[model samples]
Target chain A: MADHTATSGTNRKVCVEHLFKVFGADPADTIRRIREGAPKDRIYAETASVAAVADVSFSVAPGEIFVVMGLSGSGKSTLIRCLNRLIEPTEGRILIDGEDIVGLSADALRRLRLNKLSMVFQHFALFPHKSVGENVEYGLKVRGMAARERREKALRALEQVGLAAHADVPPANLSGGMQQRVGLARGLAVDPEIMLMDEPFSALDPLIRRDMQDELLKLQQQLRMTIIFITHDLHEALRLGDRIAIMKDGRFVQLGTPEEIVAHPADDYVAAFTRDVDRSRVFRAQSLCRDAHALSADEDAGVAAERCEALGREALFVVDAERRPLGIVRHRDLERDATATPGDALITDFPSTRGDAELVTLYGACATGLPIALLDDAGRLEGVVEPLEVFHWLGGTGAEGGGAASSGGEGEATPASAAPSETRRRDHG
Target chain B: MADRISDFYTLPLDDWIEVVVKEWLVPNFRPVFRAVQWPIDQVLGGLEEFLLWLPYPVFVVVVPLIAWRVAGGGVALFTLLSLLFIDLLGIWRETMVTLAMILTAVTFCVLVGVPLGILAARSDRFAGLIRPVLDIMQTIPPFVYLVPIVMLFGVGIVPGVIATIIFALPPVIRLTNLGIRQVQAELVEAGLAFGSTRRQLLFEIQIPLALRTIMAGLNQTLMLSLSMVVIAALIGAGGLGLTVFTGLGRLDIGRATLGGIGIVLLAIMLDRITQALGEGRHAQRPGLKESLTRWLKGLVQGSKAYNERR
Candidate 1:
């Protein structure tokens, strides 16, 4: 892991190495013992210190949303604040864009904060007495921008968050979601290269939380700013993260992309979190797709029907040499039109989705009474997404490795439109 | 039990104070004392001359207008009637003199108090040190300190102002410290994260948020100043305090009653005005009728933007 992170160090917008933040007496001594391989509990027992972030190390790539996820008191928040020296690390090197910020003088640190990084607090720490416009302009004012320029920039930032009209209103008048928007705008106004967001949406209601997540994703796409988002919500981490680091007891248990995590959780702690994830939201079409079981468009209909029957498939996808889907040909159609080629019996009404399309987007397409076609970005047939597989995965009963066959019962019955209970019955049987 | 507590060898606090004053403070602190006294005299003299010099009607009109604008019409009407009552009692001159003395003491108190408060709020060590000093300043009886002031600086309006300042300075300092300390930690963190200097954070974030509380402190200080300024009359500081004192001395009930009434009116006016300033500009927005009238006036005058903004 260290080798992997060190190789990517050149591209890192922020890199933290051996970061330890122990909150109590003689934190340095505790950090030294931790480095010497003492267990955190043992160290705490010996020193009466709580190891908040214990010997953590990671590097965030520029423009990546690196989410640090954990339960409360898991030290995820402590780790992110350590990135900007907001919570000074007990012992470590925090390099931002090749410069070590750990020992930067107060003057240099202020310059780093002003130009290189900004933070959006979890509670939307807007100045209560300041107007929304003023709140957004705060960083610029600290940088000593002229009054008129700062105002224009502040107005533009507010407009970016769809709050231009609320510029003059007090922050107290805005809802929690709107207040977080102001927080986002305030960070954006500085146009910092990286933003440390400490669970910016954790304070909002569920619906608003999702809305802010979408807004953040949209903004990230446009700005491509490096963001270190802290959250305890696994679903939120999966939804917004490019790569997520799961923290437990102030140590990162696993670090991988959302798909990697869902497909293969690192441990039972991670597995428990993934169990309740809405698989439709987390898994993409690619994860659900099985091999297309396609026949050449020129193949004889009888041959295609025989292939489908042998494979226990109800239908076959007929594709050209380039693997562009021609259409689906049901086994019955192939059997009825034995003289015709598979292309002649092809039914073009089947739904096709891209490989990267989320299962939520594939739900309607998959419900068309025919097997859903999963295609690559070039429109080449990838595979078919079976409804039974989707239900099993979403219901958290499916194994991580797919293609586990159901035993006994429903031997010849088509399983595509089977209710979830029927699919479970087949599986248990 | 008392003898056991004292150990029959008690040190004399007053003798120590006397020795320290004569031996240490008199020779080393005389110039500092004179320097401080100069400003108090200048401000008191300037304000006294101005207040007494103003045409009575002009002063009365201006005060009522300020009251109307700041605290609204009810307080404005009260101010007008109260001033007129003082005038009828023929102590308006004396009332203005008392106002001057209170104003001078408050100015000095604010100048000294706010900085000490900010210092206390910033540093834990300073706060710890200043806490007991503030307690002593507050708890010591005014007459007890007046004796020391008379012995050191002699009796005059300046000494009286000094005495009043010592008594009234604690609240402004305490409240300012409290206000800044009570500012939300997250806001302070936000300021720091954005690269604000210690000075910038104090002025831009902490002070503005603490304004209302600081103003409450000022209000307390002003009221304290009024009461102490009255007591300072025993040291020969002339104002309404002298009238009340003279009235009491010769058993002149009517005179003392008039003087007491003037101080009450002056206290109410100052309290209402300063309280309004502390509450911020829009906090005392006029009633619906006045707002409607202002809106209509703006509409008739065709100041479209102004009316809409309100």
Candidate 2:
């Protein structure tokens, strides 16, 4: 168990290995078929069982936010519940703090849930008969906490979620968002090291959903608990995930940071997800940066002009000896200043952006038509970001426009849509 | 031809049952029945004598006060007028005896039924096993079993109370089972997830949520007990039921009418009070004793919270 690192280090807070949950009378044959790589439909046709969760494995680092993103029925919720042993796995090893919780005695599992882990449900499972305070105090009460201490702790937890005044109110009186806050407070009251949030905000309206997301981010920053959040919304996943694992038909299609997923989706399914994403918000200037070939201010302009023509580049950043961008030297200007130095051909006051600026903010910078000089923190030139290259990277729909459609006619649509973006990149590369 | 057709199919079901029950079941179970009867008689007799010992006006006043506390002013006034009318008819002793018998039967029903109901709720196999038995118990006419109970335990208030208990027990058990089962599954899961023991989860979460349903079951049990207690008077249980029985035997219309009025008034009053308590309306006013106990609980709670903060 110690030797088997799920996907990362042995120090991981949660590790799930080869988990399988088949929903039917005879799971053994179906599981065997699944293990041999038979797809869900074929296995269901043969064995009369739905493999709700297939052979899935991932580990969450201590204090890391791991989001499992998938559509409904994709087994994301089932997979997370498997971690806490809420849904008993038909086959797997779930190691929480290096202890295999799947094999724990009932008492030990209860203790783990009480002291080490907590969960938030999608529908906010607050006790209808209990007040918000009592709901929060539930874990403490189960642990045999003194009534007063539990009350104090519950109040403190409520205060953390900005619902202190509502401690005595029944959960039914609160709206959906507030009720979810109560659920969060209940989970928080226990002070568990890990929180299994199963689509905690999915039941709210869009406005409340966004508000709750911000509140969760704030809470996570202060608490730093390892969170395994499940959601079907790609936008929510991108917003909250430090690292996301995209699930499809009970298997992870890809796992990476949000930027990595948006910029380089692994397949057609992932690219289909990317098409709906607001690309400007997801990609930063660094993602679109190209290597900036700079001419030194002292370099001769006739040579600069020929170099630009040979390279088929439209412009160059005129930089000092220290490589700090002074200004752009357009190809036309360089040609006009035949014997003059590159500095004499320089067109100063070009629009520039910091490497960390989002592409959305850099659109106006790109409107100036000269290459946008991408600078690092100390104002040194990192790269030149041309508007056309930015458009190509943003407009093209990831791997779908490339390798995924390799099967003849399917490839036709891929290249046809990619044609315009590719032309733009070529014209401006 | 018709006579032959009717006679040809006669099965002697009555003779066979009579022989089996009277010759076999009664002889074997008689001692067990007698042993159980001793306690029921003692409890019923003691309660009846105590209620008889209370002066009529005092009894009327105390009962109405209890009614007022449980069901509010209007029901209490109704109870007062009803009891005064029963006293005016000079059948207060019989009314007291009837009340005692009904109380004892309902109490025994609750004590036996609730735990069995909980057991049924907790296990599918147990519930399945009990379902057919409860169905048979509920479906059998009460008078049919009263004869067998009298045969085993002999005719008296003891046998009467025993029969009343049997007739009343089914509803409480069925309702308790239904109530526990009706508790939201999510709440039970929450309780288990928070480390509550099986017992704690049952008492703290399931029971509290199912409280209203369980109370409704209790109210049904109480009403059934009252009905059965009156019917038990035929076996010499002696109460307002005996008064009505004796009055009807002599064809004395006025006496029977007065006894009938007493039963209706008692039934309505008891039903309303229990139902009110079940609905949690009785908690609207805390008596001095209850308030004192609550204050003490508050103190303990406060100190515990203070210590926890430290």
Candidate 3:
């Protein structure tokens, strides 16, 4: 009996307000009590409540990445489950579009989940007895999709996730990453409006996690579906979230863009959380450079000097003949040598990063205050190293590194630089 | 060879416990249960229950209903023919009495076993504690259990039911524990996260999810009860089983065969229906049917809109 009743201002899809769920003893009765204003402590005392999810509320815009992050028990998973009433709320209301879904019948809620919302479980929850195609078509079968249509849709979904090749295989035969892709395809098969992922890639090796993230980004770009992604990995959250909500003890401690969260953390918990973050790796140089005009690449020194003399524009990107970035030549780096030509004293700094590397590794790499080079395939540079620019991007005091930023030494551009490799094995006892 | 065959069929516990444990226990816990038990328990349980309950009246109604639901009208019609053959042999009344005996015995089993199952499921220690007893209950020959039941409860349907409860209760209890334990841990967590009271989680998610397995146990119990109910007729229970036993004593193959037919009919029906209901994944998923089901008086304001929109 989900209230499908339309109201002018309320969202018609799904809304959950101040929902609380406690296990043991007629949970619906607990919700009834809570609506009537039962104290949480008393509710706990009476029902042996675990307080899985406390009063947590966040709206998902139509096409944004809203991530919920927390440790294993933080109730982030519970909160997401509450959205579709897959997990019923002990207290409060969930509105879908504009409908209060808390009271939805199991079938209605399942239909809603099937038609409008799809979730990927941490364990993948693929029916072990079903083939990949059958698993993907489960919701369609439940929705009464004809065999041909559902098969076509399932195959299409598999294709989107690059798993059409494994359509007939049992899910268990595949690796964790492949299984997760199958899970992703399963979630996408129904063409759900909101895709809810419960730590979908947490089980994958680091390398696979990044690939899956990119794959998800690509899908999100194509589908423009609102995504509520859950993860405990901070970097994963920052990598994918348009906005992230950090949760603890069944409560959201902070909610903001990764930039705001990294620079001005709400409190001690958030500050401690972001203590080791490498601002350079995460923040873009364009968003950071205070004197963009002064950074003249030595390769472009003559051109910049001509511009500065004429139009007072002091900086320019130093580049090779093919427009590959070497580094930035400040007025000083150029003035230090009168013999310096844009050719003779070309800035040797190579391109640094896409500014989306994992902050933990980037922090370690940036400790020497070196601007790590960013490169595309074929080893060509795109921009100057901006490791020092990260501190400024973080909105810390605009202090340049005390030493000259080192140009990136020769290093193989491996997936390791992005995230841990999928095949990165550890000895198990 | 004749002596050895007779003795083999009736070996005492001294010669049997090791065989039971080796043949039943180890494989059921480890590598392959069905593979091991196909030649033993399941086959034995099926054959024994069939032999004991096949000719009873309860089997008649049950077999057709089950056939109707699962195997469809053709099977139902086929099933009815086999049953009326027993009645044409004129053991219908006695078969009805045997059905009563099995139903009574099963009622007693459920009464004692369900709570025990629930208790064991709720407590690890209790479940562990019952493991040995359940195993022993399943392994010991039916006669050993009957002797004590007869001494304590006296001879009749009451004593028979008591003995049947002792024999059949373990499967239901064991399966209940197994079912509850088998419920996905995440579904329980979902229940908890949903603010489901522990009770609600147990009743709604845990119990419902565990139902198929639990139903399997119930089916086993019903089967065991029906099987044992006829044997209990030996001690003056006088059901369809009594007719079969009596016919056997008088060497009247017609009467014995008719009685056997009745019990088989009942077993088939009850087995089919319970399994059909238990295996149902969709039957229980609640939703639009309620929207379709006209509520008394009228649809709620919320429901009315749901209907209009749909």
Candidate 4:
């Protein structure tokens, strides 16, 4: 296995330039229409079929676990499958290291599968008949390893997933998490340079889902396989993806780092979609921190009171030892009538964000007023930030265009015209 | 027929001969197989000559080796014991003749039936055309195959071998098709992705994976051949089956018992060994039990809900 190279400057993992995948109803004609820039509606009317994925284009960087996220009917799953030619595209090019994959013959496709790619299906498609080991060994066997070697590889893959003992047994004997691990091992048995996962943990219970996520995190740390994961869950996307591509209809609305996407959503659709996220969980203190507040080396309650009145902010940053943010001092804490401190009151009444305390973590764990202080890696205070800044970064209150981002109010004709957004409409229906 | 009935194992001499002729002799000569008769006949003649020239112990070692590889140790041991029994029965040469006949029939099944099954699986037209014919081949008693076989092929090991193939070919075809069809879709995709040609996919992945199920069909075919060939004895298909049938013709119960005992031993040995081989590591691994248990539990609970819904 190659060492986990970051490939920081150049990415050659997977590239699709001018990729076109057309399915159903005279795909050739549809492609001709779509190519001539006939408006999407006119093309659809003529074809009586969708451009499930239109002339889309993107490239995933090497060693980066990029997520392609979309709600149902967005063709995200189809797009991923098209990468492996499980669902072949009708036109244009898909290149890996600048080689066109679209032109590959069946034998060539098989060779590609054997050598580089392994897929984790949404259903965790473990071969029901094989033991966990055999399931793991399947790709190895296909790639023509001897029995003993395949067995050893299978065991090693299983061990990586913390399922070494279960390798000798059937996957059916495992829990859902364990079964998913077996699927992961099966894909890993080939020692694939790239892994494609389609909503691999979507069906698991939440706790198991978290465990699977942790497992992926651990595996990615060790293996650093270039991964293109598809999912509809924003939480999942944020938690695992190094870079996220938000998709809608048949196009990508935005692609950026989780922080970038959260900080500046392309539109209201992304904003509303990311609304429920615990901001503190998604936001970093570094992004929100300002310079530490000034303070007297030694100030009594009387002097502190005068300083508080002078600054009419919602909260105050308390500094200590160094000129770094310490605990917080709320204006209200100075009033005895309120939760604020009264006459001769100090600012220590409220729970303060220690310099080292992560605002997002503290915000998630506790309900504290913002302008939360930033802290150094050690316990010393750095600066302070408003919780509202997190909301601002998420673009919950500010975003650009109206696409997948304007998830609210823009109830247009969805796939199922008659049904509201409660469910995806049966296009045929 | 009632008066002739002695036990589950025994039938009247005529009844027995009728079954062999009907089941083993006539059925093996399917139109497709017979269509290639010129080449098949030449090959068969050559093989017969070759085996005839070979010494008994050599045949003994060679035949047992085939049974051994197909199943392995237990079956191999049973094979040795069965050969010894036939030798002790004073029908060593005849039993060897029957063994040759069986080997020939099985080889025919593998050649014709496997391809037919694969074709049927790949194409609806083939399956549609063959289904009714296979159903008839299976339901008809072994005795029903005789008169036509006798008229067409003439009496001997060649004709008897023909009959045996007919009776045995259907299962191999059906199971081969079934096993191929039942292979998991993802694995098929995996094979395609990994560079298996359609032919390679079929032979390397599909066929190997399907072996356990196909072996079941093979076991059935073998057992059917062993039973049917005894009646092929009347047509001069010299084997243990014929010895038993001839013994019964003269009301020689002791001779019949020995012949019957030899068939039983051979059948048991074949069944145990093939069954063992068919017990794929996939099947023997502990996971299926858990899955089976889980499914059964789910099934029982589902039934309870079904009852409630009713």
Query: What is every candidate's alpha-carbon RMSD to the true fold?
Result: 7.0, 6.9, 17.1, 15.0
State the lDDT at A121 in candidate 3: 80
Which consecutive 10 residues in model 3 chain B have the weakest lDDT in total?
A: B33-42
Classified by CAPRI criteria, candidate 3 counts as incorrect
Candidate whose lDDT is highest: 1
Question: Best DockQ goes to which candidate?
Answer: 1
User: TM-score, each model?
Assistant: 0.86, 0.83, 0.53, 0.63
- Candidate 2, position A303, lDDT: 76
Off by over 4 Å in 2: A1-8, A36-48, A260-273, A289-358, A369-385, A398-429, B1-70, B281-310
**What is residue A406's positional error in candidate 1, in angstroms?**
15
Q: Among all windows of ten consecutive residues in candidate 2 chain A, which has the lowest summed lDDT?
A: A420-429
**What Cα-based lDDT does every candidate model obtain?**
0.85, 0.82, 0.66, 0.70
- For each of the candidates, give the backbone clash count: 0, 1, 61, 37
Per residue, candidate 1 scores C-alpha lDDT tens digits across B1-310 of: 6658568777799889899989998889888888888988999999999999999999889999988888788889989998899899899889999999999999999999999999999999999999999999999999888997987788988899999999999999999999999999889989999999999999999998888889999999999999998899999998999999999999999999888988998999999988887884544543444689988997877877768889
What is the two-chain DockQ of model 3? 0.04
lDDT by residue for model 3 (B1-310), tens: 5667766586587557656665765546544432432333333334445646665667668768766756457668767886687567676666656666566556656667777888899999998999999999999988787764554445765566567667888998989889888877754543333234446557656776687888889889988988887788776676678878898999999878777878887677667656666665344322234446656336587678888999
What residue runs in model 3 are displaced by over 4 Å at the alpha carbon? A1-50, A90-93, A103-108, A291-388, A391-429, B1-181, B185-223, B235-310
lDDT-sorted candidate list, best first: 1, 2, 4, 3
State, as a TM-score between 0 and 1, how close model 4 is to the true structure. 0.63
Q: Tens digits of per-residue lDDT for model 4 on B54-143?
A: 887886787677666655666777787777776777766565566667767778898899899889888889888999999999999877
